[model samples]
Target: MKLSVWTYEGPPHVGALRVATAMKGLHYVLHAPQGDTYADLLFTMIERRNHRPPVTYTTFQARDLGSDTANLFKTACQNAYERFQPQAMIVGASCTAELIQDDPGGMAETMGLPIPVIPLDLPSYQRKENFGADETFFQITRALARPMDKTPQITCNLIGPTALGFRHRDDITEITALLSDLGISVNVCAPYGATPQDLTRLGAAHFNVLMYPETGEAACRWMERELNLPFTKTVPIGVGATHDFVKEVATLTGVEPTLDTARLRLPWYSASVDSTYLTGKRVFLFGDGTHVATAARIARDEMGFEVAGLGCYNREMARPIRALAREYGVEALITDDYLDVEQRIETLAPELILGTQMERHIGKRLGIPCAVISAPVHVQDFPARYSPQMGIEGANVIFDTWVHPLVMGLEEHLLHMFREDFEFHDDAGASHHGHKAKPRPDPEARQPVTADEHPGTVVWLDDAERELKKVPFFVRGKARRNTESFAAEKGLSQIGIDTLYEAKAHYAR
Candidate 1:
């Protein structure tokens, strides 16, 4: 809960619903109105979940807002418990309900439900969905934990598992396979095959493998302090980190360490090749601190990109990330302000913008190519195939997202060879004409070339997809359409406005 300078770009609670539905058996009882329930679409469309998130909304209308709010909650809870009979239950409230101060946690505790009741305080006003996810998992695990003597031994809970995770299936498969080879058992995965009953078993596990930092740090620390369970501080998004994650888990579990030659080495080679081209590419990054930190490492160390900009909307875990950003000689942008983040993007003007869905809009408005590296994901990120961003597979995804956007990649070589008549410009200002080029045209001027002037002329979409335009905050559809139309007329592909921005500037008009 902190300052958020800019209004959020997407609809509220959409991604959270995507996650709730993605998990097969999870149930979420929301305490809000009908608009809040539109989140179901996130699963159906983006996450492609055929089944609904086990969620029930109080569906409180303004008419019933005062008369039966408490009764509505009780009925919702009873019906949810009766219908779903979830092993673990989450009593969560959205930003709207948080204002009324119902204290669902207090209600759930007072009701004395049979299952483990996790009261989650996810005030949309104060925090983002990622924080809710991490807290939700932690609350569930803690709700199910038992006293130490009764805890299971050598068993560990795999943390940071959530709905529609970037590459959850692959991450779990690799880690589980690795641990199984050493005869280690995963007691429970917070969101996978886990229940209130399995929670007590969490105390038995000797350690926790924190797959993602933003989501797992709290639970991992609680487990360590409360149950003496150790956690591995490994970010398993690349080849080396994957290896280290495995090794560290082995050490904590007292199991013999082994490696999968195919799984481990191929990605390292792929990343190396990717780095060869992406090296020194100006890149900017933002997300939850954990993923942002991982992206910064891969962009700078593995991919040879210059971190022209770095920032995270989450400040709770900003210290370590901030300290690391210093290596690039740039101060980490740690603020909850989206406008501030946009301002930073404008100032840094990296060749590529690496950030959330919000920054994707910022990058588009700035006319820069971008890849959504973390949350606030788009439908594109959920390609038909299972592409994970953790373990070896994650390295592969990173390689593609980073190198594919550049003109210096293998495609550029093929283009050069194909059109041997065309000349190459190696100079930094080749396209800019010594920085005197006019900034992108106004969004309002994006009219189609007149029919009288150019009758029957055909304009392809890419032709209109390159120029910068003012992106309206919170109106995603308008922003996207406006950008696509402008880029088409320029004959050049999109440009990120960030590349032109000098630091120490705010996002004013």
Candidate 2:
């Protein structure tokens, strides 16, 4: 019921089109304009799907906004149906099209087509990509659930299954392996291999497995209510979690699951111990709650790193995340306010910052080595082969990223201390940093900042940098202004160079 159902924790647009691209024998008639269709690039350039979103954009322009748009939409739909004899048709709209309220759902029903039609009411402004994904999957499941009947008891549907990240294929393989080992057969994985018949047989599965938190809840509930097919909420990420998941599934399915699948060739306990050099390495944490929670376990248990601070700009997902944060004895800083995150950086002073693309810039400015732990990851997250964050190899990846960033344990701490600007504080309670916390400023003593504080070379397109100054935070304004002023003094652009001089020199006094 929370808005998190529609809110995304990362780049809302990541790999969206990849879903459409992977699904053949499906036609997508987007109720969007020309520019909105560009989502196809995620597949063409990033995920590298051969075709685009199985789409036919309405191509409605500013001119068509006034005309019989319904007719235009009808034509597009008819043409699409003719061109692609799809098993199913997806009728969807982006943010702009939602305003027009083109009820394709009603129209598709009246058409009396041979196949099913899924109407996606994904309002871009109010929601995000992950939410759209969940809702769409939900609607599609319901759509495919028409004229439902009972099925075999052994099969099960896989919820939250989308082909997006580089590791998706491997993760699926791993899940299949573990489930197969438990004798719980997978019923459908849609758009990958599952047929319409397979989708119809979804209720036949004993239950559903939700791999990701983003798209699982709605479909799980619907299946539970309609088909009495219950589901598991655990996201099998780390070693301990995976082991726990295997046990749980074994109990649920009433099968004696052998560790033959997850327990591989290598000695698990001894090998994990082999990577103990990574323990206590100061690590910064930020990302979506789901991935962040998983990362924390991987950092502490698997990778052997000590997390300094955990924060996420994605506030919508902070609920399930807080427990995970408290486990590490740190309250997560949940805000889109980048400066606050920066302040957290100063406080935790982690040797390595594991975060999103935005943190790449912050880490560079702060002189900390970093690797992107979660999304909004660019093409770089995917290596030549499938480098997944699953199984033993995932543990290895964690070990390498956490360890390569710094030397083991206290050495990393001493390095950050020596290199960073460590100042004395009185309270010593802000965070892990032993520095004394600064006293709050008296309201009466506070004054409006003057030109003297604004001294800096104003860089072209420095609006964003300047925007950081107006943040209500007293500390952030000071730091951003100071950095800008320093750049101005050096004739570099970021902040205006010497606000006083720039003004006075322009005037004839």
Candidate 3:
């Protein structure tokens, strides 16, 4: 594998850990090297769980390679079953351990443990984290779910919501409440709060509600084919989508749709005079397929924003995102490389970015505002507050999460615009207090990065640079690029105030 500073997805075994750790009575035994144990810190530290994930690692070192590493895996599996006494166990090998070719799944089967031992054939080199999670859940469901009679009342299994999912804990609460209001009861919520025994009861539900398709679609489709259970396709993220979701549920369960949106404030807030500035704002979206698609629709249709760019890092989602991008008349970017994502953001110069934690860092470096909208997020995204990304309340949370960054960015821009004022200057300290502000580095003192360092090739004169500063900070980068391209087309070597105004008027037409 190529080495890089960041990655969108980990190897498949980590996905297996996500499913195992999210459940109540399932354990994961990973055949990996000692260094591979670092993955446990992800759930324990980032997710801030009180207990570590239910994972047992073989942790074989270099010295043990000459000897039998397979024996180490067998020992770990036996110890895991004995110590934890889980209802079921899943076994797999990490990317590094895969080179040894110990065949973890075959070894797990021969052990003949009293409890069910489901072997996971997660190919680290060929597959990724989401695929691993999907396949693992599918295998578990296929092995444990039995044919049975449906419940008397209309019920569905919330077939997704794993550990470390983007706001999955709260999404479950929101969706479950919405379903309860529609005269439907939930039979079980799998892979999150479910047990291995709950898998057997999965068939008792009349149908399933597929929340995040990336992690749950495989299992849901399998159930539809094997158990004759139908699942919902709509993801209730925004006001419009939530309404549509309720109607879809009505069609499936024969219950009249009851949309209780009295608590939703997004529609009223969006049309208010105070929010007019947000209209026509350009936004870039990059994340998982489901979030990117849902956020794009919300941004354009619900929030009155322009879709400057749209993309996803997951290759599995390329086709849908591409089609959506085509609908918006922009090329879709489908790649895992962070550098490619960063370069595209620079070219687009969107006023705001809704993406993963990686895009947050990219935004900060490029002086743009960003909000986290998908997985591969930081610890801060997992707030203690009950913020969800689905249901009626979720629309309110989305309004706040996506808009706050732009609002704060505007405040910072105003501060920069009036920095020359004695009262609002950087050294003026807190406006409400008389205390002296801390000494800050002077921007002029540092070696200025040339405008030529960016995408364009045109030079800028001192007067033109001062004139360009008058443009709002949010659109300043785009203005500069546009002026440069205009100058280049006219065969001008250097840009002046006249040229800047001329380019602006030309583009305004």
Ranked by lDDT, the better of candidates 2 and 3 is: 3
RMSD of each: 10.5, 12.8, 2.9
lDDT of 1 at 236: 79
Q: List model 3 lDDT by residue over 1-509, tens digit each.
A: 58999999998988999999999999999999999998668998999988889999999999999999999999999999999999999998899999999999899989999998998888888889998899999999999998899999889999878998999999999999999999899999999999999998999999899999999999999999989999999988998899999999999988999988899988777778978989999999999999999999899999999999989988888999999999999999999999999999998889999999999999988878898999899899999999999999999999999999888888877876886688877677667776655544534232434556754546687788877766777777778889989999998877989999999999999
- Which prediction has the highest lDDT against the true structure? 3
lDDT of each: 0.66, 0.63, 0.90
TM-score for all predictions?
0.73, 0.72, 0.93
TM-score of 3: 0.93
Q: Which candidate is the best by TM-score?
A: 3
Clashes of 2: 17
Q: Which runs in model 2 stand beyond 4 Å of their true positions?
A: 1-19, 146-153, 191-197, 261-277, 313-316, 336-343, 407-509
Q: What is the lDDT, from 0 to 100, of the residue 148 in candidate 1?
A: 65
Q: Worst 10-residue stretch by lDDT in candidate 1?
A: 499-508
Per-candidate clash tally = 24, 17, 0
lDDT of 1 by residue, 1-509 (tens): 44454443232243344335544455778788766776667666766766666789988878887686877888899899899877766776767777777777788788888766777766576566666666666676676676565334466678876666665656687677667766777877766545556666777777788887666677888888888888889877766676787788887766777766564434455455444655677888887777788888788767778888787876567888788788779888887677788788766666788888788888778766678787767677777675677776667777777666664334543533333132322222234365654343333344555435664443323223332222222222344543344444544343244321211022224
